[model samples]
Structure formats: structure tokens, C-alpha cells
Target: MADDRHQTPASGPAPNTPDVVELPDVTRRDLVARLMKIGAVSLAMALAGGGAVTTLTTAIAAESTKSERKYRYGMVIDTRRCVGCEACVVACKQENKTPPGVYYTVVLENGFGERPDDRPLFLTKPCFHCEHPPCVPVCPVGATFKRKQDGIVVVDYDRCIGCRYCLVACPYQARYSDFGENYPAIEHDTPWADVPSPEYKQFRQRAEGKSPIGNARKCTFCLHLQDENGRYDQAAGRWPACAKTCTGKAIHFGDLNDPDSEVSRLLRERQAIRLKEELGTEPNVYYLV
Candidate 1:
């Protein structure tokens, strides 16, 4: 059983031998076998090294691509289009059934001075929905978080123990603690009994009216609107009610990732700014100066 790698070549004459380059047939065959074995070993080593390099390169490239992916969900509010219409404020109140004093949306009126020629500008204010939301840390319970999947700050109502710490911690004054109350006259008009929407979409029983009824709530960026089914709705040209009801079309909502999307284009083209930019909360919501 000759080793496969050392198998001898077929027998032939070994009579001729030059004086200067004298070598027996058996010696020549042995030398040839040794060279072939070394070549095979070198080839195997080269292939193994090449394979390792290729695998590592591919892995590193994939990681670099993933890490370079920017994930800052944001919005652009065009102040020029805002016409002091409280439609967004009214729509939000209607959509969320907010108590008389608790408002999820408001308009800040900036007056240049009281005079005939004085100008008053209206700024639509909603949850800034900060990237590093301050509300997340103050909660004794793990109720609030910025979702890594989409960067939308959210409050888990079930986990919220009606503590208003988040409400106070928020710089934008976003959170609102719910009070169990409903207009007696509008009892038949349950806002939750309609098409899909975040304001009234997912409902569970509040514990003896202590549920979300007493828990804090805030803008969710219309979470339901970000779902796959919602995108299907958007493709058909339907948007969230607040944006749909804006007569001036001041509010724009779309994927921040798609560079060509309306929001993305506005961010690039306008002198957009977020509220309290100095704090470095990195609010996703932006306002056009």
C-alpha cells in the first residue's frame, strides 16, 4: 500500500546516466514525488489562507455597510405655510378626545409687537419626540422608550403608573396625564369606533378607570401610520388625519430614509430647525425658520 501521494511512476529503463548530471531513475522519481507533494501542500495552504481572507473581508464589509446606515427619523414643519389655523390643534383634540385642558397639540403665536404693522407668526407645536428623550430616564417604571426600530419615542401605557415625572422632565412639554372624563352629551360619539388610528386604535380596559384613563399620554407620531398596512394606505395618498385636515398643508410626513421623499427633500432645501437644539435632545421634529 504505497502512500497515494508517493506512488511511483510506471517502470522504464534506467541505463543512461551522464557523467556531469548523473542521477538514477529511482532517485529522479523520488525527487519528482517529493516536489509534487510539496506543491500540493503549498497549494492547499494558499487556498486555506485565501478562503480565510475572503470570509473576513466579506464580514467586515457587511458590518461597515450596516453601521454606516443613518437612522435619524425626523420631520420638517414649514412655517411659511402655517396660516394660524387651529385645525391641527382641533383635529388632535378630536382624535385623542383630550380633556378640556390637556392638549397634545398647540400653536405658539410669536408677535413682533402690538402695532398696525406688527406681524404675528404662528408655530405649530407638538411633541418634539426627542432622540434622547428625557422622559425615558425619569420614569420609575419602564414605561417610556425610544424605539430602536424606528426611533419613535413611545409610552407604554400599561406600565405607566400615572406618574407625571415624564411630563415634567420633557422640555417640550409633551406628556399629558389622562383624567377619566367624557362629555356626557357626546357619549354616543366614541372616537375609538372608527378607522385605524393611533389616537384611538388600541384600547384595553383601564383598571376601574385607572388605566390609560389616568396614565400619561403623548404624540406617538401616529405609530399605526408607520406600520406596513399604513404604508399601503399612504401609497393610496391617504395620510394621518391631522396632516390630512391641514388646510395650509403645513405638516409633511413621509419616510425620512427615502432621500426623494417630501420630508427628506424639505430637510435638504429649507432652513429647518428643531426646538431647543442646544440641549442636544436631537428632536426628530423640526421647524422651518
Candidate 2:
């Protein structure tokens, strides 16, 4: 029996010259497959990151625009039309239910004194709500401050410690210490005693030794009358009691920023003057002398 078998080839490629080896043929399909394996996920992640950045930028821009729409809410009192009636004062008391020594507004009877003209001059004075408020920084506690949304100086009865520093710091005499004195009706425990004051929208009932009693009190420009957007509706009577009840039509309240508003028109038409502008307080309250 003969054994027929294939013999092994022992000779290999030359070591001196590099052997040329054939590789698999590559095509566009191969490139596409490779891209799908790695580049696809990278592209998707990039698109998602770009979308998130766009959304975040849009939201921040909207918030910045809203914050810039700050309102310098203030008053323009036409002194020429004021008749010294003090209706505004009485109306303020009725609205805020201010106690003794806690007058939110007052009329300067001889503010202008005897002028050359025969007409008597009476200036209605309220919390000026100065741009650089003196009372805010003077507060030992953070009891009083001005709102950035609306330039209305506010006193936090909860935070006040009866220090009265804010009262002294106010150059406009806008602040006062509430000593908890009440009217005869409250002292007698009559039906009016239960009446609640709608200050800062707190609606707190009058009581002795309470928060506001020991706190610094001042005019808030009747801020409680404003809407959520800090707007006052004159037609609907949702306005400051003083301005609403002014028989002389002297008090004009509106956003000073709005050129279309009546207060803006008045300020443009007339020469307005503020009390103690030299003090650098920059009072929002203006008087048409």
C-alpha cells in the first residue's frame, strides 16, 4: 500500500524586503458604517447640548427684560390747584387707620409762607420715597427698605425693634414711631375697635403693644391699593384714598416711566419741584409750584 500525502512548504517571504500584504477592499459603505458607530452619537449629543443652551439663554433674556421694567411709582402734586382742604390727609387716615403721632401724610399750612401773590400756599407732604433713601441704611435691623419693583419705602413691623433710628434718619420727616395709642372708639371697645388696617396687605386688627405699635410707621404711597402688577386703576377707583378723595384734584399718581400717563404729561407740561433736591435724596414726590 503506497501513502500519498502533501508535504509542507518551509520557504517563507524574504525578510530583507517588506512583504506586500493584501487587505479587505474599503468603500463608502464602510465609511458610513464607521461613522454610525461613533460619530452618530457625538452628533446627537452636540445637537441636544445646543438646544439646551438656546432654551436657557431665552429664559434668562426674558427674566432680564422683566427685571428692567422697574417702576418708579410716585406722585405729582399740583400745588396751584391745592386749596389746603386736608381732604387727602383725612382720607389717608381713613384708609390706613393711622393712630395718633402716626400721620402718613400732612399738609404744610405755611410751607410757602406769605408770598407776593394773595393766594395762600399749602404743600401736601407725604413720605417722599427718596431714590437714595436715608432711612434704609440707617436701620440697625433690616426693618425698613425700598422695593426695587416699585420705589416705595416700606417698614417691616415684624422686624422693627422700636429703635426709632429710621425715624430720625428720614430727612423728609416721613417716618414716625407708633406708640399704640388708639381712638376713643378703640379704647371703649366699640364696633370700630375690630377694624383691621390693610397696610402691606396685612389686614391686621388694631391692638395695643402689637407689631406696628412698637415699629416705625411711614407712608407706603397707598401701595395696598395697587394691583399685582403695581398698577393703580383710577377709573375703577382702585387708587390712593388721598388722590381719589382730593377735591382740588391736586394729587396725581401714576408710573413716572410711562410717557402716556397723566402724571407724565403733567410733569412734562409743568415745571415740577421736589423738596430738598440738594440733599441728593431725589424724591419721587414732586410739587408743581
Candidate 3:
């Protein structure tokens, strides 16, 4: 008998030949949704065949009934109250123990005009944690994500490949790439070098070739201070270091979703503005100009 594997019938083309099929153009969001659906179906079949029907059903039910948003954590800064003292900047450095040139928050000064008589506007800027964060989708490794519980955008340093895609995607220039630069205290092997940063509830000591050393970093709203319920207690001193330490009490942080919350109330009464609103990033951080 002749081997059939290599044999081709008298036809227009080979049997195993693939035909080019033109697919419809899909937007990124549609592509992602389709991929998620494919994954979910695959997982469901695997679990069902493995006699884990209950688990699969429960998971599907939970996903189907997932809430749109539990909280919208944000900040409202009163520019009038800001003294440009940079106390918030200092507090953030001390709290996060960030390396030199890797500040999660910064104070920017803008003059009203080129004239000397123009008054300078002080802006304390941090990660906006946008409702539709461009940074999250651009990260190829899925290292950065917006938390479903509180809407805080965070980075998973372990998964980050340091591609810096998020940095470029961010309109606010909020994300920073860690180049492993250390402060003088850590560089000189001083006693302060032993202190670890309690970032993301991970007390990581600064060292060469570490996860955060090469990962993209950003502000997390001091989420590490939140309790297991994902709630910050200002009375317990569990608030964000920058907001807590603002010398002029310029920064207001709270759950914007709650209408009664301080941030929401401020938004209702004060004339607030967000940066680059035309981009439609929907930044959580608002400035009371």
C-alpha cells in the first residue's frame, strides 16, 4: 500500500492547505472581550469535565453578577490652600522610601504669565488612577491593573518586564521606570539602608536585581495602609502619607463614589477641574482652581 500522508488527490490544491480568510477589523476592546470569552469557555469546559461543575457554576455566577464599581478612590486638591512647601513630597518620600528621581508624587509650579508680577500656581500631582487608564491596556505583561475593589491602579512588580509601555501611554506622565538608583543612605550602607518600604503591603528592602528595581512604579494611594476590607481609617492614621501630611491641608482624599464622602461633597460645592479632560482618561484627581 502507498503512504497516504504525502499523497494528494487530483484537485485544485492540497488537502491540508490553509485558505486565507479576511477577518473583520476588531477594536482593541472587542479583541480583548473575545479573548476573555474564549478563555472562559475553555476554563468552563475543563472544570466541568474534571467534576468541578459546582465551582465552575459559582465562578460564572460571580462573574455575571459582578458589580460595576464598588468604590471610586480619588483626590481633590485645593490649589488655593497649597503653600508650595513640598511637605507632601517629603512625606511621600519618607513613606515609600523611593529611590532618588523616582518620586510617586511631585509639586509643579506654573506661572500665570511670563511677567514677574504674575502669581505662580502650585500643583501637587500624583497618579490620576484614571477610570479608563491607558497605561493598564498598554502593558504587554499585564503587570499594571486597576483594582476592582477601590479603583486604584497598581503595578505587579514581579510580572513587569520593564518595557516602559505604561510610562509612554500615561497622559499625565505619572508612571516612572525604576533604574535601580539608590539614595545616599542606601548607597553608603548607612543604618537607614536596613529600612524597608511598606509598598503594596510588601516590605521590600532595596537591593540590586530586585522586582521593583526594574519594574515600572507609580502611586497607589497608599493602599498598603488600608485594612483587609479595603478601607482607610484616618483616625487610625491609615490615610495616605501625602494627604495626611499636607502642611496646608490642601489634599482631600476619599471615596468619590459615595455621594456623602468628602471628595464628592467637595466636587459638588467647589469648582474643580481635571487635567487633560479632553483625552477622556477621566482622572480621579481633581484640582479646585
- Give the per-residue lDDT of model 3 (tens digit) for 1-289: 1111233333323222212333356554443354356445554455534534434444443333222357778999998888889999899989999887788999988722232556677899999998768887676656677776777888878768999998999998898989999988999999999999999988999999987999899999999899978899999999999999999999999997677999989998999999988986778999997
- In the range 1-289, model 1's lDDT, one tens digit per residue, is 0011122222421111111322344443344343344333333344444434333333333223223334445567777787888898888776655555577777777722233546667787778767567887677765666655455667666667887998999998877877776554344545443323235356443223655677788876655544443341456544555666788989887666566788889887888877787885767787776
Off by over 4 Å in 1: 1-72, 111-117, 186-200, 204-208, 229-232, 235-238
Off by over 4 Å in 3: 1-67, 111-117
C-alpha lDDT score of every prediction, in listed order: 0.60, 0.74, 0.78
TM value for model 3: 0.75
- Tell me the lDDT of candidate 2: 0.74
Once model 2 is optimally superposed onto the true structure by TM-score, how far is the C-alpha of residue 210 displaced, in angstroms? 1.2
Q: Which candidate do you rate higher for lDDT, 2 or 3?
A: 3
Cα RMSD (angstroms) for every candidate in the order listed: 23.2, 26.9, 15.2
The digit string of per-residue lDDT tens for model 2 on 1-289 reads 0111122222432111212333245454443343344334333344344533333333333223223546777899998899999999999998999988788999997686765776788899989987668887776656677766776778868767888888888888888888889889889999888989989889999776677888889898888888877787899988888888999999999887677888889998999999888986778899997
Q: List the residue pairs that clash in candidate 2.
A: none
Candidate 2: which stretches are off by over 4 Å? 1-69
